[model samples]
Target: MATNRLLRTAGTVLTATALLLSGCSSGDSSPGAAASGQPTNGRTGSADTMPEAATATIKPLPTAVPAALRPYYGQKLTWRECGIVGFECTTMKAPLDYAKPSTATDLKLAVSRKKATGPGSRIGSLMVNPGGPGGSAIDYLQQYAPQPDAVRARYDMVAMDPRGVARSEPVTCLSSAQMDGYTRVDQTPDSDAEVDRLTSALRDFTRGCRARTGARLGHVSTAESARDMDVLRAVLGDDKLTYVGASYGTFLGATYAGLFPSRVGRLVLDGATDPSLPARTMNRDQTAGFNTAFTAFAKDCAKQRDCPLGTGSPEEAGRRLTALFKQLDARPAPTGSDRTLTESLATSGVTAAMYDEGAWPVLREYLAKAQKGDGSGLLALSDSYYERDPDGTYANQMFANPAVNCLDLPGAFSGPDEVRAALPAFRKASPVFGESFAWAALNCAYWPVKPTGEPHRITAEGAAPILVVGTTRDPATPYPWARALASQLSSATLLTYEGDGHTAYGRGSDCIDTTINTYLLEGTPPPPDKHCT
Candidate 1:
């Protein structure tokens, strides 16, 4: 099971939920900046000056490619039709340890692309990544890509699964059965024995990851993946990268821009994550974000008929939901299957629905069912969140999520005592989901690999204007992160969507879509103060 700090894309969550019903499935510290619907730090200059200023400010890449890295960068991609009709897939090579490059140490990475259906000149590849630190970029590209026809007509859409993620030498830990049990393990433990069991499960998970994944475990950091993206950029014949990254992908994109500022071209970071926060702060803030999202859901639910938590204030709704969680904790609810819905899974189910408001109605139904001693609906939602197929198998995302997160930064808490110490604040941030998210944040503490990166700001100086998009009530990445990231990047223009869900683009907002599509097509970012409802 991945930590609750997981930065998931809205489309991926909503899309997975759609399949499951059918039968399948941050950090900024600025006063008033995080919660505000409006952009915080405004970009200088008027709208007319924005386009030229953005294009002209970009720094040129060095003329020569590093001699040591040229072979990896210059290697040809032999694309073949990979089942999906219009999509082509290929494997690209990257040095496992960039510090030491050789054929013996090469790692094969999966790359996929759909060539432009053009009436206009090609505008290079529009690379995309849909968060997860572990979510498959190739899978996301297949499911949701080339969203705008005009943009698709002018650019080849491309995606590369980052190292240790889906299709790119994935990290696998638990078996299907192990994962099933792992997911059901009580995250919000009450007794000392339960706490020990939870900690034991985490230790075993980390051990399995270390035992199953060897040296490659140490090489899956976002920095390494960012470097791999540069190689992909060179191989694709693009002097600069034009890209869209959502959720954790925002962090990946920001890392790329920071690492290779001169090569950034028309980058879009929607549902932005703040790279400046430590693991603890990120997890805690995400807890608060979920609180904000659920409050929105509760308010909407209260106005509807047969609302599970009744038509009262959000606090009342939260209390009713909390009572349901307690009931499950004591006596697991039957889901018609052998796997009963424990409080942990129940929490995950509700948390999953909080990602996109489209799932709100479904959440209401599931909560109603759970109240009546039926947990199947909520279990399905949790299964979708974990990407567990009907066959009981699981995706590699859960494994890769921690592998990358633990390496990216230190653990949120070192031990159970620390978690207990921190629970008050976590609960204060989120009265309902806080305790579970707080304990979930402990997954990285047991990781075998020590962290290679730490909390820091990403300036991405001299990078061509990067659009930092945020949704006000975004559960995963939160709105304020967009503000913080925009302020950090020297050339970023903050675009706000005063709405619900994880991301703004393609989520029924013409304003958000037009602003992003225009920027990608014409390199003209919306004014920094732009906020759409």
Candidate 2:
């Protein structure tokens, strides 16, 4: 998951309250109110008053199964020509709406597997999810994940694109050109007119998605995606679902464990997000986490000889960077090409570089260029964050991002007035990030579909022990979220990676890699509170 600006300045209680209140309008009810089926004080419509349904019950295993079930369930999938060597691709069908299971809406899920290459006994499929809620797991598998020998040796490595994401039924909202317009919309609204413009952009974005893809939009909730995973598990014939999830994928994995506790096996959640937090709180914590990561970057940049910012101290470096952002905000910088980099793009570029230490040097170089009035490097970083291609085409991240995130949790703020009231608090939490991110929270405010779930604990009481990995200086999923989630789960072991970057496993920490690999291969959970430097 990329660092979202909306969550960076969510620490103010008054702002959160105002945002909540603004959600309740006499003429219009926000999706959060409607989907929650909670009462809105000002709204008279019954749409917001629907009774909460009983939690979906998982059925007992059937004694007799059909012949078709045999091949998928407990059958070893043979690897064949899947474009990539040693990898095979297969499709599994899941109900589009879990609530209407008997209905005939089959969502196709793309699955990939690389057979175990070890002399030891082969474990079942070990699934992986890179956090995006919108991130392509198959891309992650083919690119970064499968190279890990220790993991591939013992288990058949697998990755599936969740429904409405890539390789699955992709949910697209804007065309490439429209997306460019949307991305360029000023995120930092300084005046009432600017706030209205921001809101209009958000509403227009949501409306565009609804217009482009209406039927599939409402069905992309996390709960529905979790059910799809269970279907994948059954088709793969794994008695238990062994998996690894990072960032937002942790929430997906944890939800799966919660929904089907009896079927969980050797699950590992890295850079975990706490499922028990409200959107506002989660946003605030993430804001602080990014600031923490920025401080770390500043410290390192100060030591570099080519550092664009002054080398006196990290704080001084941060001040210089902040001043640079403000300068860009006032007068955007020109790239060699026709494109110019705005403050939002510059901030996004900086945020993208914060994801991995490997990118820090590149970021410093870009900062130096930007300081010299060249914006190409920073623009390139922002383009990567947006997943924009050379042809100006985009992956479905921006569109599918809100489709999944809004459904997973309610919005943080509801209106411009609320945002204005919360500005002071947001500014205090993240002076560098507050305005842009606090406005980013508005993305969900105009979502066409309402959220289907709320923040909740996922104990999965009877499930096997699950390993939760947290990076000490992770910019996306804060370490404390990992701690909070581990504490919430009944059978969870917290593994701490005292390091930088978004996730821990396979990122160079021998302690983290070895521990997670052993557990995946041998079914032994890492020791509780195990710290890896």
Show pairs that collide, candidate 1: 20-25
lDDT of each: 0.77, 0.69
Q: For this target, which candidate reaches the highest TM-score against the unseen true structure?
A: 1
Estimate TM-scores for all models. 0.90, 0.86
Task: Please list the residue runs of candidate 2 whose C-alpha ends up more than 4 Å from where it truly belongs after superposition.
Answer: 1-80, 102-104
Which tens-of-lDDT digit does each residue in 82-189 have in candidate 1? 847899999999988766678997999999998998888888899998877688889888876536888888999998999998899999888899999999999888
lDDT of 1: 0.77
Kindly list the per-residue Cα lDDT of model 2 for residues 473-524, writing each as its tens digit. 8877789988978987889999999988777777777888889878887789
